[model samples]
Target: MAIEWKGIFPAFTTKFTAADELDLPLFGKNLQAQIAAGIDGVILGGSLGEASVITTAEKETLTKYAVEQVAGKIPVVMNIAEGATAEAIRQAKLAAAWGAKGLMLLPPMRYKSDERETAEYFKAVAASTELPIMIYNNPVDYKVEVTLAIFDQLQAYSNIQAVKESTRDVSNVTRMISRFGDRFSLLCGVDTLAMEEMILGANGWVGGLVCAFPAETVAIYKLTKAGRIAEALAIYRWFLPLLELDLHPKLVQYIKLAEQQAGLGSELVRAPRLALVGEERTRILKVIDSAIATRPVLPDYLSL
Candidate 1:
């Protein structure tokens, strides 16, 4: 179950009930859709999955459930976004024990670690687990940035296999390729930048909106890889409005709302993140509804 680090890997949203409990049935349904749509892997407890609010036990539950659900049809990757290095390592070990095939590790959360500290944290975690890791290098959302120099230091860890490149500059894909070559697999982390990055040689996509629109997201990635640019661009153009929702602060609520609209999941976010309402709700629904209304007929992307 090693990670190939190529193709669509959704940063799946954790479904919650009205009482703020894990809605496994709904979560499983969406996961089934993602697998059915031909994703390369599934990441649990990511930013989109409300990782901060989810407790360790809950994350383990999610990892175990997803592992069982996918049943080795695909890799189940657990996201380790802990603030403490020891905690991150502990989670990595637990994820391995729970059957997670890979990890998506962010720089130490909350505290903005210096480059040296960041490299140490990553190295420490990498040494602790044999699991293949995808570094979440999202400087825009998270204050810390994993620059190429830091990656130069990290290249020693053979398990540090890929990067979730979210710098938003599509050119960074080429930059990573120029610097690292195939030393590290590069996956586009931003939904809006997926097509651009993919065209520039990104190995995969760690998508947020794919939680709601798995088939369309996978379509764009598959078509682009097949050298079907015109067909991919047509779908990407139609999908632009819905994809923009992932760049917002309240992405969890926004994406969960889209899931609800698509009959995929509920919009119940954890405390501190209330579900979208009033003008905001109306505005977002307009985007989601409009996209659904004009949803394009997909081609046989898998056959490509």
Candidate 2:
């Protein structure tokens, strides 16, 4: 099946032992749990998984492992963006060659700083592969905006199928949908604005916090899709703290800790990216406790 980029796609975490090498066993297990929980797809090597710290070999291996583990149960989208065009192409080619269902494209780290430059950059990367690509409009961290002009131009490419809208601006999401008119599937990259964006017109969500609590994320999607707006809002209310955490500079550490506390994955981030400790660890644990307390109760899992 051609993977649809139109629903909850968990930007899953990278697991590690206390010693911190790639924990493929834990990684595969977590992927399985998310799939079984009813996620539309599994996103490997995304910010949620600390893709920036990992080497190309690690990304390649994880992409291969995740794709194989999903085994057509769900779409497996790998974050193939790099600071350099050559590296992005390398990751995308490797993931495509390995049978990943899709690629999540983040702009080059150099930051186009403007629309024409951004358009040119995306065009360059889009020309590199035939795999369906989801443009990651992560202006929150990237400082790069996916302006309407840029989206209109990029949509001309058949492969630029979806976008991870990281902007919190509602007008931006509404404007894009109005302009493109289903030409692009806008996935919520910012957790806080997900409900609002969906209310406006977003088709899906892709973010760091959802990986630690897949069932809750899936529940929100199911409820919303079924037209149960009140129920979805209640679930969304409980997820607010998590939405706030995504705004923090220490987001990766906090997200990994939540996964660890949930018995999902390790908070073991690679070096240069230090371990969460002192005040940061305490802060994250409190958030995890709250998420566990308010997280939706689901079948086949522990009660919230």
Candidate 3:
């Protein structure tokens, strides 16, 4: 399966059984919905998926399950978040073994590395895997910015094809296109800025809230790219509040809560990560519910 690496690729949240185990059946259900909703691709073990707490075995299981459920209807890209080069390489091979079509490779997990070290980390991982890679660059969350200079050095690797741009600075989108000139495919990684990024020529979207609203997400991407600004803005304006949830630190909790409200999956998270409760829970739910109450009717083109 050749991943275009363009359009809506949900950084899908992982589903857990009430006992906090991998809920394969339930997770598969969500993956199927993403495909049926016409998303471009699906990503597993991402930040929204609680990658920090999930073990290697669990990640492999998630990768294999996504491969099985998607069944080549779309690409299942595995996300590799590791603390060392060797570990990142190991996991990249593991994803290849599980039949993942692509990899979303992040910088060193905890320790922030300098430009040289970070470029080397990505290079080493690229050397180890045959799978096409999308470098995850979330400076706000990860604290290590894969600056344009670092990305320039990365241009040497052919398989290091795309970037998940989460610098949170929309101007960076223009800078990437101007400097790289399509040398690299740039996917907008921030949900709130998806519209602005796409308008600025982001090749695709590495989305967070798409876990709950796949159709709306795809509609926004398709509409924007089609030059349907009026139609896109209608949806983007309505979606802005929910999209803001992705910017929150507890984005997993907020997104999972939205998924549950949207009847997609359970909000059960792993230990050390508890479900939302009391005021926080109510606050998030109010936002989701208000969106549901006044959700806009989909454009006919989107229904296709």
Clashes of each: 0, 0, 0
Cα RMSDs, all models? 0.7, 2.6, 1.1
- Model 2: lDDT of residue 192: 83
Estimate candidate 1's alpha-carbon lDDT, on a 0 to 1 scale: 0.93
How big is the positional error of residue 168 in model 3, measured in Å on the Cα after superposition?
Answer: 0.5
- State how far residue 193 of model 3 sits from its true place (Å): 0.4
Off by over 4 Å in 1: none
Segments in model 2 whose C-alpha atoms lie over 4 Å from true places: 111-113, 298-304
Q: What is the lDDT of residue 245 in candidate 2?
A: 79
Order the numbered candidates by TM-score, best leading: 1, 3, 2
Worst 10 residues of 1 by lDDT: 12-21
Please tell me which model should have the higher TM-score, number 1 or number 3. Answer: 1
lDDT of 1 by residue, 55-150 (tens): 988988888999999988999999999999999999999999999999999999889999999999999999999999999998988999899999
The prediction achieving the highest lDDT against the true structure is 1
Instruction: Write down the TM-score for model 2.
Output: 0.93
Please rank every candidate by lDDT, starting with the best.
Answer: 1, 3, 2
lDDT of 3 by residue, 1-304 (tens): 7668788899989899987889898888888888877888888888888998998889888888888887778898999899989988888888989889999999998898999999899999999878999999988889999999998988998888999999999999899899989989999999989999999999889988889988888888888888998999999999999999998889999999998999898888887889999999999999999998888887864543
Error of 1 at 123 (Å): 0.4
Query: How much is the lDDT of residue 152 in candidate 2?
Result: 81
In candidate 3, which residue ranges exceed 4 Å CA deviation? 302-304
TM-score for each candidate, following the candidate numbering: 0.99, 0.93, 0.98
